[model samples]
Every structure is written in structure tokens, then in C-alpha cells.
Target: MPHLSLSDLTFTWPDGDPAFEGLDAVFGPGRTGLVGRNGAGKSTLLRLIAGDLTPDRGSVTVHGRLAYLRQDLTLDPNRTVDGVLGIDNQRKALHRIESGEGTEQDFADATGHWDVEERAVATLDRLGLAHVAPTPDALGRTVGTLSGGETMLLGLTAALLGDPEVLLLDEPTNNLDLSAKARLYAAVDQFPGIVVVVSHDRALLDRMDTIAELRRGELRMFGGNFAHYRETVEAEQEAGRAAVRDARADVRRQGRELVEAQTKIDRRLRYGKRMVAENRYPKIVGNERKSQAQASAGKLRGNHADKLDEARRTLTEAEELVRDDREIRIDLPDSVVHPGQQVVEVADLTLACGPTVSLAVTGPERIALVGRNGIGKTTLLRALTDMPPRVPWRALPQRLDVFDETRTLAQNLADAAPHATAEQIRGRLARFLFRGNDSDVLTSALSGGERLRAALAMILLAEPAPRLLMLDEPTNNLDLPSLQHLTEALAQFRGALIVASHDLPFLREIGATRWLELTDDGVREVDPR
Candidate 1:
């Protein structure tokens, strides 16, 4: 078993905003899920632990070797599969030694790794990349030829080949198909080392032994999986709300008591003034009594004010314990379709390298498009958008590159809906959690989740609206909160929907009415349950 400890870690971006400051955590053996909202520094923390990025202050200590699989993996097109696997040199050395053309250095390079090729093949096979493993020149194949999902799996395979005691995976499931996700899940479950993963995939988090959440520059660890963390946080929030309620009541009660006490003191002062004015007692006696009354009134007022201040402090402390769980709220009644209206009519359409099929969607049918990677799910979605039916339609591509990166979110929405005014665009974007100046942010600067939200705003807020909406892997890079907002927003949409995704739980959350699986033969309807 190995341990990874972060002591007083601090890091800041070049722009001067601190991603993390004085953060500390200890991760021992077993799988740990690192979850947080977008831009919460989950990826930054992982990079720090991997030593890919240096911290501005403090240190990251690892008891054993460490390996990291980054979220965005860029490989040279000319690089071979073996090169990407990092075993090419060892394999070459072994081959040279075997062919009697090797030097002493070749033996040293290949020492203890004589079966490196075999191990590499086995690792790739375990990760569902066996198709590339068996080819005679598979190891020499160009990386550009592999699919995006296959490339991600290859990265994981390389990491596993290193056999590091501390493994860090950043959004490993992104772009992966369902089968690949399953394979990755199995690998994580069986891994004996300390595995720390930063992902938004709920399915993957459910398999973790611990859940570590980073929020607002602090790290909090919760025992068990995501489910357990959810349960614990929900319970804590409920109790916090109750405490706030009690504290608020106490403040109100103290306010009323202070007012009553002040009223009594005012009455006493008025009586003392009347006694002095009427000469009800001797001048000296009346003056002495007035001074005593004033002193008493001042003491009473000070006591009440102090009590009120103390009550307010207690209320503030109570409020601090409650979490801010705000969710997006949006309504699209204009995009709604009648029960008898035809949404989509695909007649004898042939997708690129996909099945030829005919389908019709009436009313607000929600379709879940599922399939393996490279089976042309994206192609099918594009084809549907190309030959749109009588109704207005829009397609959200997997890449989410529908917007102009140079422009702001508001400008993009305005461009999409030429008839809409700037105020209208901003108002609509606000519902998508882009309030005020947030809509002014450049699309290029937006995070993955922010970009998705901005894209959704542009599509949904366009002129005439889209009654037939298609989303291709919309959940790919979304954080948990963003995913929830997406699900909620989709649930409120009354238009026809075709959502292509590998996240089964998300599909179910949005209430998919129809399940369609794309295959080599064609698109066929199936039961998602």
C-alpha cells in the first residue's frame, strides 16, 4: 500500500486567481473519487499530484511511484502504438538482442523486460484495445488512425503498464463508449494501488472506496462511494437548515425583547421629565432622580443591544453551515409541441457507415441513442439534422463547437436569434446560470460545463425555437452540478429529443421515452431498462 499526502499546498493561475490555497489531504490505498464543480481545481490538483505542474507553495509527497492519465490526451500523428505505450525502446532492444545484433547497452535496456511486448498486448486487451494488439504491425500503427475513444483507452493502457503504486486518472471516461467504460470500471475495481480519479461520471464514482470533494479551496473527505457521500451531505444540509431556522427565530425573539425593553425605558424617562417639569419633588431630588433614571436607561439599552448583537452573530454562524445548492430554472413553452404534431420523419435514410432506417417521432418523444464507439452515432445525428422534417430543429454536436469562440456568450445567442434583443438574450442566458456579466464571458474562455450551457442557450433561445432537438453525448465533460442542471432543463422541454449518450443514468434522469441503439445493420428500437 502507498500513501499520497498534500501539505499546505497552494497554487495560483497566471491571471492571479488562486485555484487552491493551503489545501491538505492524505490519500492511502484504495480508489478515491475526486468530484467538484467545473473550475473548482479538480484537474489542477491532480496535475499537481502528478508533478506535471509545480505548486506555488507547499508540497505533494508520494510514498511510491506515480502515474497520471490526463483528461485531454494529444498524441503525435506519426507516433506508433508502441511509442505511445512507452515500450517501444524496450521492445526494440529485446528484438536486437534476440537477432544477435545487440550490444551490452541493449541488454541493459531490455533487462527484466524481455516479455514487455507480451505484457503490453495483455494490458491493451484488458482495456478493450485487443483489436489493435493482435495485428502483426499493430504496435507500429499510426496513432492518428485510432478513434478518440480508442486513444483514451490506449493512454489508460500505458498508465497501467507502468504499474505505479499511485495512479491518477482525470476524467478517464470522457469520450469512452459504454463497453470501454465498463472495462475501465473493472480495471479500477481490481487495481491494488492507490487510485485517485477526478471525474463527473456517476457510474465510475459509485465504484470508488472514498469520495473526496474539493470546493471553494478546501478539501473534504467522505467515507464510501458517491451514493454514501450524497446521503451524508443531504442529511447534513437538512440539519443545517433546521439550525438556521432555529437561529432565525431566536434573533427575531431577541429583536422583539430589545424593542420592548427600550419602550419601557422611554416611558420611564418621560415620567422623570414630567416630574421635573411639574416640580413634583424638590429641585435637587428631581435632578438626582433624573440622573439615576438616565443611567438606568443607558444600562438597559446597552444590555439589549449586546444581546441583539450576540443573537445576530449566532445567526450568521448558523447560516454559514448551510450549503448553497442553487439549481438552474428555465421554461420553454414556446418550443412545446402538440400531442398530435409530427416532430421527425426519417424515411429510408442511410447514415454514413451506419444502418439504413425509417423512423417517425410524434409529439414529445424522448429518444436515447446508444451504441459502441465508431458505430456512427454522431453520423446518424448529423444526418437527422441535415434532412430535417417539417418542424424546426437543432443538433448539439459531441464537440460543442457550434458557437463562435471569439465572441461572448450573449453575442452568440444574439447571433443565433437575430430577432432577439440584447436584453432578451441576457435574460434567457440568466436562466441557464449565466447571470449579468457571466453572459459577457468569451466562449473561448468558458469551461467545458459553461460552454455546454452557453451552447444550449444559443440553441434553445433561437428564433422560432427548436421543436426537434438532438444532443450528441451532451454529458461528456459536464460536472455533476452541470449535469443536474442539464437533466432538469431537458425534463422541462416539451419538444422532441434525441439524446445520444453512453451515460445511462443521465438518460434515465431526463426520462427517455424511447431507446434506440445504433449498429452496423441500422438503428433499432430497444428497451433501455
Candidate 2:
């Protein structure tokens, strides 16, 4: 079997923050999906496994050739398809030999290089890039015009061309459209060697043979796909929560017993003192009785204290097993709009991707704007929000431009909603779960979930509080928990919403009243369910 294993693997960042510590894991010959929270170090673990970063202490043992497809490798605008596929050098050498004017070394260099173009073309074709021909000109096609999904697929093709037996992919589906994701999943399903992918895409994870979760510096493996992994975790969490409740009750019981014991001891001591004062027995005999009572009291108190301490320790352990995923409780009281009120109306508006759209919104209508990647979905949203509207509106672009990284989250929200007093902003931040010192954390240091909450605050709490809110692919950058937070927040919005997203599950969760698909011709109503 083509085996990959890690023994006592450990890693830390330059700033002394540990990403992984004493991590040991093994992979059999199949696709394994890795999942975790935003800062749980899934990418770091992949890097460590791929040998891109050396472990602080331990070993990575691989039984076959390895290749890694990085999640965020930015392609140069000038780079060609052949370059992205990593066969530019080979193609160039082969071209030189094929040309009428060529040196003898060029022919020798082209020995193994001749088949590079063929393999590249076939791989790309297999990945649904049949548009990329096998010709030299097609190989020279630039990557600047390719969509984000196509670029990602191109990277995967390059990795495949290496004929690696062990492949590692980190967030391979980020920013990819539904079609691209489907193609990627198919490719993963067809891989002949062991593959490990770290991604938040549920559909992609479902195709995996196993799921591995890294959390709180520990890596755990589950024997099945993402759905199975989630089921197991959910059951375990339920049990853990019950354990915590039991432990807490035990602690309280022990506390009550300790207090009762103290009270009894105090009563006994008072009785002993009274007997001594009364001279119920001889002075020496009374003194001995008092000493014995004091000793017994001390022993009883120590016993109860020990029991309470043990109970507290058990409670702590139980609490650690249950994740504390705080939620965003959005309350937009000022944004409420009556059912008869008109929100926005547009007619025959041309989009950047050649589609003309026209739509009207009223009351608390929720609209889901969905389309393929590189289409005019985002552009249409920008155009709609930029036009003069009869009502107050706000837009949250996919890049989250609403935040200023230099300031704290509270400061950023304050800047966004300058008309509001500091107290108002603090209250809004609290509802988003950034309470007290949490709101004071720098925006740059905020996690993906925190940033989402801050972004919500920046737009929704702004001046002339928006009655119509527009968000562009909000779920693209969010983790699973953050996605849920966003859904929860959007659910509470009592205003018109125009959300552009490729996430179907999220759109459904938000209870979008209307589904609008931006086609090449124009926008049309479609039932995504």
C-alpha cells in the first residue's frame, strides 16, 4: 500500500504560536478530507505533511512520490496555461527540436519532453478543460482570462502531471463555482493514489473516504466521509454535554455537603465548648474531648474539600469536550419595513457580463442572486446598490472592504456608523457576540467568524440605517460555524435583502422568498429546491 504517516509531528509559527503539537496520524491509500475551524491549522498540517515546512520535532514518512496543490497560489497574469500546468519548459524544449533551426542538445532534451504537452492536454481535458487544445498555441494561452475555478483546476492538473502517488490539496474548492466544484470532486473520486484535501466545502468533503479533524492541537480521525464524521461528532458532543451537566450537579452536591458538614462541625464544636465551660467532666478530660472534636472537624472538612476539588476537575474536563460556538443574535429593530412599502426597483439594467436585469423589491423581501463564477452576479449587485434608491441601503462586498485593519473591531464599526454614539456601537457589537474585551481586539487579528460579525455591524449599524441590505458571496470566506452565524444573523433581518451567493444550502437556510438566476440573457426565477 502507498502509505503516508506522521510520528510525533509538531510545528509552531515564528511568533511562538503552536499550530500543531505532538500530532501523529496515518493515511491509507484513499481520499481523506481534513476539516477544522478557521485557525485550527488545517493548512499548516497539510504543509507539514507535504514537506513544505519542516516539523519542529518528528517525522513524515511517505512510501511513494508526493505532490502538493497549494490553496492560495496566485497565478501571474503573464503566465500561460502551459506554465500553470508546469510543462512550459518541456514544451519549449520540444518546440525547439521540432523547429527547422535547432541544436543537437535540444533534440536530446526533448526526449522525455515530447509527451509533456500530450499529458497536459489529456489531464486538462479530463478535468473539463477540453477547450484547452493540445496545440502549441493553446498551450500558450494566458491564465489571466481564466475564471477562479478554472485557475484552480489548472493548478490541480499541474499536480496530477507529476504522477504523484501521494497528493495533498488545501482548500481546493475555495472561490470555485458549483460546476468547478463538481468537476473537482469528480477528479478526486477518480484519483488512483492517496489524496488528502483540506476544505470547508461540504459537497467536496462528502466524496472523501475518510474525514480527519484537527482541533485544539489534537488531530482525530474518523472512518467515513464528512456526513459520517459530523454525525459521530454530534453524538459525542451530546454525550459530552450530558457529562458536563452531571459533573456540574455533582460539584454543586459536593459543595452543599461541604457546607452542611461545616455547619454540623460548628454546632458540635459549640456543644463541646459549652460542656467544657460547664465543667461537665474533669478539666483534663474536658480538654481532651475538645481536642478530639477539633481534630475530627478538621478531618471532615479536608475530606469534603478533596471531594469538591475532584468534582471541579471532572467538570473542567467535561466542559473541554463541548465546543463553545457562540452565535450572532442580530437585532435590526430600526430596519423593519412594512409589507406595502416599496424598497427598490430597476429596469433593463445592463451588467458587466452582458446580461440585462430588471427587478423590484418591496417590504422585507429576501432575494437570492445566484449564477456561475465569472458571470455578472457580483457586478449586477454592485450596479444595483450604486444607483440612487428611494430607501436607505448598504452593501457588503465579498472582500469585506467595510473594515479597516489598522483599528480595533469596535473602532471600525464606530467609523462606519459615525452618527451613532459609542454606546450604540458597543451594544450592536455585543449582539454580534463581540462583548467587552472581544470588541477591543484588532480587526487584523480577528478570526473569519469575528470578521463576519464586524462586517455585519459595519453595514447594518451605519447612518440612516439600511432597510435594504445587499451581500456579495458572504459565505465564500466563512468557515462552517461562521456560515451558520451569517445564516442566523440574516434570518433576523427584517428588511429587503439581495444576497449574491453560490452557496445553495446557505441560501435555503436564509429562507430567500425569491430565487433569481442571472443567465446570459437576463435574470429569471428558478426553483433551487
* TM-score against native, each model: 0.90, 0.85
What is the C-alpha local distance difference test score of each model?
0.85, 0.82
Top lDDT model: 1
lDDT for predicted candidate 2 compared with the true structure: 0.82
Clashing pairs in 2: none
Error of 1 at 388 (Å): 4.9
lDDT of candidate 1 at residue 123, scale 0 to 100? 88
**On residues 1-529, what C-alpha lDDT tens digit does candidate 2 reach at each position?**
6889999998887657687888888999899998887657877788788878898899999999898988655789788888887777777777776776667777776776678877888888877776755555698987665655666788899998988999999878765778877888888898888999988888888988999888889989999999999999999999999999999999999999999999999999999889888888888998898899899999999999999999999999999999886656666546887898988889999876588889888889999998776667767877877886668888887656677789988888878777888888888888877788767888876654456668877887888888888888677546787677678878888888899887888899998999999888898999987
| Ten-residue stretch with the least lDDT total in model 2 | 444-453
The CA lDDT at 221 in model 1 is 99
What residue runs in model 1 are displaced by over 4 Å at the alpha carbon?
Answer: 74-80, 89-109, 142-148, 175-178, 338-363, 386-390, 404-411, 435-442
